[model samples]
Target: MIDSIIFLIKTAFKNVFKNWLLTIASISILSVCLIVLGSVMLIVGNINLFIDEIGDESQIVLFIEEDLTVDEITQISDRLHSISNIGNINYKSNSMILEEYKESLGEDAWLFEDLDAETFRNSFVFNIKDLEKYDQTIYEVEKIDGIAKIKERRDVIERIVDIKDVLTFLSFWIVMIFVIISMVIITNSVKVSVYAKKQEIWLMKYVGATDAFIEAPYFMEGIIIGLTAGFIAIISQIYVYNNVLSPILSDLGFINPLNIDSVMSVIVIGFLVAGAIIGTIGSAYPVKKYLNV
Candidate 1:
């Protein structure tokens, strides 16, 4: 068993280096495919993170009726509290709204100097626990008597949610297509390697060599190629994300880009696993088709 293992290891390395150009070509293609796929996953991951942050902080703005009494306001507050999925319920008086507007205006606060705080409506701001029930909650909130107008940040959130699914689906298919192409390239590479050693393989087989002995070396070759490709792809991805993409995203205040550590952790495992599977399958196919004799 030990001898067989040692022989397979030696032969696999020999085959890999003997046809260095083809092996390199296969690895390069696989690395490029992996890099593209990793980028897509990272982009989608950050987008989803940003969306979740926004969604978590999202709120409904309920403008109160100017003529509603204190009792009516209390009733409205109670009604809001009674609703399911309600989180924090904050009451913003007209004065508070005006103050916020002034703070936002900064130098332009002078333009609003003549306008009274009473000109702004008093409102209730509500955070919700579940985004999926947003429409239903909006409907319920609208039916309340003391509400003069209703505004929600849900429109933007809903649009982002829709876009998220579309992007994920499209990116998945795109990555899958690239993976298939890479696998085909690797398969051909394996076939070439196998053909180069056909006479040796036949001689060994004739001399009572087991099928496993002949096939083990090719399997190891595939694994080595996959591991090398995966490592290279990860390094390339990190460089591009940190030096190229992250700097640009950092300048954009609205975007919340993912930290490198988190992304690396996921990509490392993902790349290694994907590379191993693709390598194993690619190597197995040619061996099954051509070496079965």
Candidate 2:
């Protein structure tokens, strides 16, 4: 069994080298496909991270009417607390708002030194636990009496959500398209190698060689090509993501991109597994058609 395995490995390597051009073509095609797929996955992942950051930081501010009674304020607080999706509700007095505004102004704060603190309204500022319920929460808050105006970043959130959805859809189709393309290219590559040694395969079969024996080397050839392509793709992806994309995104100010360390394992394992599966299927399909002998 050990000798048979060694023989298979040596034969696989010989076949791969003998068809070096086809192997190179297959590897190049698959590497490009995997790189594109990895990039799309990274972009989608960062977009998701950005969405979560936005959701966590997102707040709705309800400015209160100046003439509201203490009882009305208490009732408003009670109503807000009763909402299932609301989280971390806090009331900021006009004075607190003024102080915060001053802090935000930094060196320019003196320009507003004479400004009346009462110019800012007392407001209920809170986060939503479920952004999907944001519109409903806003509608419920609007029905409350003491709220004079509502301030929210809903427009921005909605736009981001739309972009995420569009990208997710595109990524799914892109993966499907590339998988098909890779399989076809790989299948043709294996077919050419198999065709080159058809007479030898027929003689081996005539001498009682099993189908598995005849097919093992070709399958190994496909797997080696896939593994080489996957490795190259991974290196290229890491370089582009860490050196090129990460710097550009970090400079964007608003984006909080994920660190490569956080997702490196996932990318590596996913690409390798996907490549192996594609290679196996590509090699198996072509070899089966020629094995009737």
Candidate 3:
């Protein structure tokens, strides 16, 4: 058994070294594929991170009754704070709103000089646990005693929610494309390697070697190739982050540092698995087709 193991090891190495160019070519192609796939994965993750950052403070603004006294509005704000899914509640009076308008518009804010914060009405800004419940929660708020009307951010929230949906769809399509292309490229590489060794495989079969014995070395080669590609992909991703992604994320101001790490982990695992399976399947087809004799 030990001798057989030694032979297999020796043979695997010999094959790997003998087909140096072929091995390099196959691994290189897989490396390139993994890098591109990794980039797509990173982009997907960044989009998700951006969406989540925006969602952390997701809220609905309720417009309070203009005639409601200060005490009444305070009671409503206090009641909202007691809700299960509610986070923090920020109550801004109409006067405060007008001040913010002036600050925002600068010199042009003078156009609204005729209006005071009272014109804007007091709004209750409260967050919810789940964004999907926003509309229902707003409906509930409208029923409150001091709420004359509710001005939930229907337009902006809908746009943000739509972006999340688009990002999720994009992730699926991107993953599908990665799988297909990775399979094609890796399988083609394995096929080429097998083609070059077709005569050797036939000789092994003629010498009474079982299929398992004949396939062992190639399988190991595939794993090694996969590991190599994974390493390359990871290094490439890190380089991209340090030299590209990080700088861009920094400019964006809310980048989560773990995003790149998550992306690299996914890509490395993805490439390794892809490489192993494609190598195994690709080798199987050629061996079955050309070595059965």
Candidate 4:
């Protein structure tokens, strides 16, 4: 068993090296496919992060009419609290709103010197627990008598959600196309290696060598090609994400990019597993035809 294993390993390495050009081509194509997959995954992950961040900060502001009495305001607050979808609710008085506006103005505070605190209506700022209920929540809030206006960025959130869906769809088809291409390339490469050693394969079969023994080397060759490509893809992905993409994204104040360290293990494991599966399928496909001999 040890000798057979050694022979299989040696034969696999020899076949891979013997067809170096085809091996290189196969690796190149597979690497490009993996890189594309990795990039799409990273983008999707960051977009998800951004979406969650937006969700956390997403708030509906209800501007209350100045004429409402304290009891009316309390009633409105109680009504808002009763809503199943509402998360945290905070009341901001007119004076507090004026103070926020002043802080926003910064050096241009003089421009708003004549602005009276009463110009700003008291408002309740609250987050929604479920974005899907956004419209219904708004309808409920609008029905309240004390509210003068309802402010929200529903349009923006909807657009972001749409973008995420589109990207996910595109990435799925794109990765599938690349996977098919990679398999075809690997199949052809393995076919060449098998053809090159046909005479030896025939003799081994004539000596009663099992089909499994004969097919093992080619199978290993495919795995080696896939692993090489996967390793290269991983390296390229790390360099580009850490040295290029991460830096650019980190500079953007609003984007909270995921740390590469947090996800590195996942990426590595995913790529390696994907590579092994692709390699096994690609090699096994062509080797079957030769098995009948």
Query: Would you estimate the TM-scores of all the predictions?
Result: 0.76, 0.74, 0.68, 0.73
- Counted clashes in each candidate structure: 0, 0, 2, 0
Candidate 1, 1-293: lDDT as tens digits: 79878888999999889889999998999999998898888777777777767776777789999988999999999999999887789999999998898899999998887889889999999876666677888888888897899888767868866887798899989998988988898888889999999999899898998888889888888888888899999899899888877777768887778887876778898888888888888899998898874
Deviation from native of the Cα of residue 208 in model 1, angstroms? 3.3
Ranking by lDDT: 4, 2, 1, 3
Q: Write the per-residue lDDT of candidate 3 for residues 1-293, one digit (tens) a residue.
A: 89988898787667667777877876777677667666666766776666666666556678887888878978998878766666667888888888888899998988988875666888888776666566776666666787766656677667877887787788778756765665555455555656677888779878988888887776666666767767776787778767887677768777664545545556667767766765565455544554454
Estimate candidate 1's alpha-carbon lDDT, on a 0 to 1 scale.
0.86
Model 3's C-alpha root-mean-square deviation from the true structure amounts to 4.9
Q: Across residues 108-209, which tens digit of lDDT does each residue of candidate 4 receive?
A: 988888889888889999987766567787888888888888898989768766876787898899889989999999999999999999999999999999
Better of 1 and 3 by lDDT: 1
Better of 3 and 4 by lDDT: 4
Ranking by TM-score: 1, 2, 4, 3
- Each prediction's whole-model lDDT (CA): 0.86, 0.87, 0.70, 0.88
Clashing pairs in 4: none
- Lowest-sum lDDT 10-residue window in model 1: 126-135
Cα misplacement distance, residue 102 of candidate 4 (Å): 6.4
**For candidate 4, what is the lDDT?**
0.88
lDDT comparison, 2 vs 4, better candidate? 4
Candidate 4: worst-modelled 10 consecutive residues by lDDT: 128-137
